[model samples]
Target chain A: DVKVTQSSRYLVKRTGEKVFLECVQDMDHENMFWYRQDPGLGLRLIYFSYDVKMKEKGDIPEGYSVSREKKERFSLILESASTNQTSMYLCASSLIGGDAYEQYFGPGTRLTVT
Target chain B: TQLLEQSPQFLSIQEGENLTVYCNSSSVFSSLQWYRQEPGEGPVLLVTVVTGGEVKKLKRLTFQFGDARKDSSLHITAAQPGDTGLYLCAGGVLMNYGGSQGNLIFGKGTKLSVKP
Candidate 1:
């Protein structure tokens, strides 16, 4: 079965601290995405990478950044953790072709900033 | 900007009840997809409808795409407690942003609870 694993199920960070969340997919898909899920706003994309060392900002990429050093791993970084940034972070991967929109997602990391 | 609007943000029903969730948009999409996310888990793809006026069925669930390709709906028959989850509808659009080929516009999602 295809599997996407995240580095942490839950995390707590202090305000102004730098935080990192990791995601790894066994499918070796070419597309990776980072999103933050909030109660009323839904899942807002933070950043995405189509290939190694390639990254693109999404609609809500202000407080977040992403890195794809290898094909299997995608990392999400919080430059300065704030209380408003507390949310469930999701990572997803998909193929590179026409059906690349079909994504497989990881369990998600719930981060709390204080 | 493309936006998908989902109706009935929250639904609670008893086991064996029937329900329908609607997703509507003003912008046309190349495809529409349905996903179910259980608590603490990421969304899982349930179905994808590419053709206009297409209807697909999986077990007790049925998904339909509008003839205009701008809306979609998901219906469940005899829903069980296991069916409780957050249902999200996403529309696919071709994108050339930063060389990214495709992107998805997601609705806010409908949270469903089935009481057993």
Candidate 2:
């Protein structure tokens, strides 16, 4: 079975603070993604990485950045956290070819900004 | 932009009832996927339909993709409390830009509650 793990299951941060969410996948998938889910908004993509050092912005990438220094790890960074940034963050990975569309998601991290 | 619209945002029913959720879109999709997310957990892939007018069954759950590949449906038979969750439909599109190989457009989701 494929396993995707996040660095934190729940996190609390103050406004204007920097925040980092880490994700690691055991499967050697080539594509990794970051998404923030909200009520009535569904899962909106934040950023995605196709390979090491390659990053792409998704539909909603404002105030967020990503890092993919290695194939197994992907990180989401918030320059300065705001109350509006509080959300459930999910990380997913998939293989390159025919299976690329079938993403395996990690347990989400619920971030609270106060 | 590709968008998926899910109907009946919320549903509440007693056990042993039958229910169906619909996902509609105006744009064609290369493939469609269904996922179920329990409270406080991430969405899990339930099934994926690639061909048009395809039907796949998993236990008591049945999934169908429309002939035009622009819509899909999920039907649960004799629903149980264990089937309570948020159902999400996503459409896949091949991307030529954005360093990403492909992208998925997700629906707002249908939250279902089955009472025992």
Candidate 3:
């Protein structure tokens, strides 16, 4: 079985604070993604990394950044946390290039910005 | 944006009942995937349909892809309480734009509740 793990299951931050969400996958998949799930909005991609040091912006990338310094870890950073950024964040991993067409997700991290 | 629309946002049914969920899109896709997500957990891949007009079944669950590759459906026979969860449909085209090939664009999802 594939295991995707997130650093924090729950987090609370004050406005204008910096937030970091970490993810690690044991499957060594080359593709990793960060998404935010909201009611009525579904899962919207924030950023994705295909390889170490290579990143791509998804549909929603504002006020967020990503880091993929290693093959197994991907991190999502919130530059200035705000109430609008509070939501359930998910991390996923798949085989290189995503040709496999399926993503294995981690237990989400519910971030609250106050 | 490749949009996937799922209908019947919520469904409540009794055990032994049959139900079907539909996912629609205006654009063609190389494939579509169905996932079931439980509370506090990530979505799990249930099935993937690639060929247009194809039907695949796993145990009591049946999945069908539209002939145009623009839609798909999931049908469960004799639904069980254990099948309760949020069902999401993701559709996307295959491209080589920096590892995004075959990435899934998702639907809002359907919350299904099966009571025994």
Candidate 4:
């Protein structure tokens, strides 16, 4: 069974504080993604990493950064968490190639920056 | 920006009811995928349609890709409470994936509720 685990399911952070959301995949997939889901905006991609130390900015990567030091681990970092940054964060992983590759996601972390 | 739009943002119905959700886009896609997400969880891939005018079935759920490759629909024969979830449609473009998962544009998603 494929499993993606996030560091926290719920988190509260003070404004201007640094926050880190960790995601680990047991499948060792080559591609990992970070996304923030909002009420009406759907899922906006933050950042994605295809391999160790290689990353790409997604549609909404402005306030977030990502690190992938290992194939199974991808981390999302918020340098200065603000009230507007509070949202549900999702992490996903997928195989690199082949036909229609699908992403497998973790349970998600609901962060509230106050 | 390739925008995929879904209609009827929210739907509530009783069990055994039939419903259809539509996903439309102006940009042609190499493939389209449907996913179902439960609360507090990430979306899970339900199906992917590659060929235009193709129809695929998974039990009571039916997925169709339009001939123009710019639209898709999901139909439920008999929606059960277990089928209640947020349905998301994503359009993908074929490219060199390399370390990247293929680029996919996602719709806002349709939230469905089935009550017993």
Candidate 5:
């Protein structure tokens, strides 16, 4: 089974503080993604990495950044925590190729900005 | 402008009941995947339909991709309390410029509750 692990299950940060969410996958998948889930908004992609040192912005990337320095780890950074940035953050990984269509997700991190 | 739309937003049913959820999109997708998310956990992939007019079944769950590749449906037979969760439908498309290989457009999700 593919295992995707996130650093924190719950987090709280003050306004204007920097926040980092870490994710690691044991499957060595080539594609990793970060998304924020909000009520009525669904899961909107924040950033994604296809390979080491390669990052791409998703639909909602304004308040977020990503890092992929290694094959198994992906990190999402919130420049300045705000009440609007509080959400359930999810990390997912998938292999490369047709069979990689399915993504395995972590247990998620619920971030609260105050 | 939600690219993917799923309905009904919430459903509550008794155990042994059957239910079907629909996902609609205006744009065609290369493939659509179904996921079930339990409370406090991220979504888990249940099935993926790549070919148009294709149907795949996992135990009591049945998934179908529309002929136009713009829509899909999930049918759960003899629903059990263990089936309660938020069902999400996602469409994957290859990127043209982004370094990412693919991006997924997801629906708001249908929250299902099965009571025994």
Candidate 6:
């Protein structure tokens, strides 16, 4: 099975703290994404990278940033954590392009900012 | 600006019951996809419908895309406890994947609970 591995399944951070969430996929996919899932807001894209050293903001990229320094690894960074930023964070990867390729997702990292 | 809406945000039913979930959008898409997400896990791809008025089936699940390519539906027959999860629908537009997850737009999702 294609595995998308998240470094942490649960995390807790204090306000104003910098946090990092890591995601790694073994499928050798070229595309990686970061999204935050909330109660009614659903899954909102935070950032994504199609290739190494490439990144783009999604619908809700205001409070977040991303880094894709390697092909198999993607990271989501919270510059300054806040209470409102508490939610479930998901990482997903897919093939390059042409049609919306099916995405394989990591187990997700649930973060709680206090 | 492209948003997909899923109806019946929450549904609770008994096993062996049938249900239908709707995914609607104002803008036409090239293709649509359905996914099911379980607690603590990422969403799993179920089916993708491309052509307008197309229908695809996976066992007890049936998926249909509207002729206009702006909407889709998923019907489940004899839903089991394993069927309990959040169902999400996404649509693809003119080759713009914006940056993340290959540019997929997700619906808010329908949370279904099946009782034994």
| Tens-place lDDT digits, model 6, residues B1-116 | 98898999999999999999999999887789999999988998898888999999999999999999999999999999999999999886544545433367789999999999
Q: Write the per-residue lDDT of candidate 3 for residues B39-115, one digit (tens) a residue.
A: 87889999888899999999999999999999999999999999999999988667576445657799999999999
* Clashing pairs for predicted structure model 1, backbone only: none
Tell me which of candidates 1 and 2 scores higher on DockQ: 1
DockQ score of each predicted structure, in the order shown: 0.64, 0.63, 0.68, 0.64, 0.59, 0.59
Compute the TM-score of each model's chain A versus the native chain A and list the values: 0.96, 0.98, 0.97, 0.98, 0.97, 0.96
Per residue, candidate 1 scores C-alpha lDDT tens digits across B45-102 of 9998999999999999999999999999999999999999999999988877555477
For candidate 4, write residues A14-110 as lDDT tens digits.
Answer: 9999999999999978888899999999998899887899999989888888899989999999999999999999998888764566778899999
lDDT of each: 0.92, 0.94, 0.91, 0.91, 0.92, 0.90
Query: In candidate 4, what are the lDDT values of residues B1-116, reduced to their tens digit?
Result: 78999988999999999999999999998889999999988899899998999999999999999999999999998899999999999988654654435867789999999999
TM-score of chain B of 2: 0.96
Question: Which candidate number maximizes TM-score?
Answer: 2
Q: If scored against the real structure, what TM-score would every candidate get? A: 0.97, 0.98, 0.96, 0.95, 0.95, 0.94
Which residue runs does candidate 3 get wrong by more than 4 Å?
A: B98-100
Tell me the lDDT of candidate 1. 0.92
Worst 10 residues of 6 chain B by lDDT: B93-102
Model 2 clash pairs are none
The order by descending TM-score is 2, 1, 3, 5, 4, 6
Score candidate 5 by TM-score against the native: 0.95
Output the better candidate (2/3) by DockQ.
3
How many Å off is the CA of B5 in candidate 2? 0.3
Best by DockQ: 3
What is the per-residue lDDT of model 5 for residues A1-114, given as tens digits with 9 covering 90 to 100? 999999999999999999999999999799899999998889988998888998988888998899999999999999888999999999999986556267889999999999
Give candidate 1 regions above 4 Å deviation. B97-100
DockQ winner, 1 or 5: 1
Q: Where does candidate 1 chain B have its weakest 10-residue lDDT segment?
A: B94-103
Model 1 per-residue lDDT at A58: 90
RMSD of 6: 2.1
